[model samples]
Target: MSLLDDDAFPDMDSVSRDRVAPYIIRTEKRKAIDANGKPLFRPRRTQMAQVAWETRHHLQQLLYEAVTDYVREGYTTRPCARRNATSVF
Candidate 1:
């Protein structure tokens, strides 16, 4: 089953709906727990954002290092259409 019901979010665009659907499900679960007198531990938005930024940054760094290594090994002059192509990320 989909996390988000299309009928409930008919006006939302696909990308935005996808991003928010999980959060909506989490909030509903938290509310259910709260009704049962259980403590809810929601993460701060800043912390989540920081983690995403760090992950993206690390991936970019790795891509840069790979490209640099390929170039340093005298592969820059070769055409990129080969089976073992070196792509710049």
Candidate 2:
């Protein structure tokens, strides 16, 4: 029967005031690895990878500049990738 149906309610004539208790509860779950501060795993994001790629490209360009200008043509340097390409050699 529905709670709204008066017939479902404990009879007021027989039920005592102390007998009713519709209390509420709240909770937060802790995993097995729950620690004082650190999380078990780091969240995923794109900005970190973008920063790393920028650093790598900048370093590659600087090394290319140094090798082409300051070094001799016969001298061998670690090959760097060209634009839209995978490998230099």
Candidate 3:
């Protein structure tokens, strides 16, 4: 089953869990070690912050791209002004 299938993995709801799922699965299948086969510890706070920042930045870029695409496609519309400064009725 796919990891995105919530029914297959109900506990993968939290942001932290989603971020660490790949590492957790890899460690479970093999020894957690560095390139030199040395043991590794949990990621530091700064590392997690960097990951979060990158994720947020990527999402913002995607949203901006989608908006620009819509505008370029001429799908965006602006409402007409109901009144003008010089108009007198």
The candidate scoring highest on lDDT is 1
Global lDDT of each candidate: 0.53, 0.43, 0.50
Model 2 segments beyond 4 Å from truth?
Answer: 1-56, 72-89
lDDT of 2 at 55: 64
Q: Please list all clashing residue pairs in model 1, or write none if there are none.
A: none
After superposition, candidate 3 runs with Cα above 4 Å error: 1-55, 76-89
Total clashing residue pairs per candidate?
0, 0, 0
Per-residue lDDT over 31-87 for candidate 3, one digit per residue giving the tens place of the 0 to 100 score: 578899776766445533433346659888788788898776545343222122112
User: What would you estimate as the lDDT of candidate 1?
Assistant: 0.53
Q: Indicate the residue-level lDDT of 56 in model 1.
A: 52
Q: Using Cα atoms with residue i matched to residue i, what is each candidate's TM-score against the true structure?
A: 0.23, 0.18, 0.23
lDDT (C-alpha) at residue 47 in model 1: 38
Judging by TM-score, tell me the better candidate of 1 and 2.
1
State candidate 3's TM-score.
0.23
RMSD of 2: 26.7
User: What is candidate 2's lDDT per residue for 58-82, written digit by digit as tens?
Assistant: 8887887777875554333424322
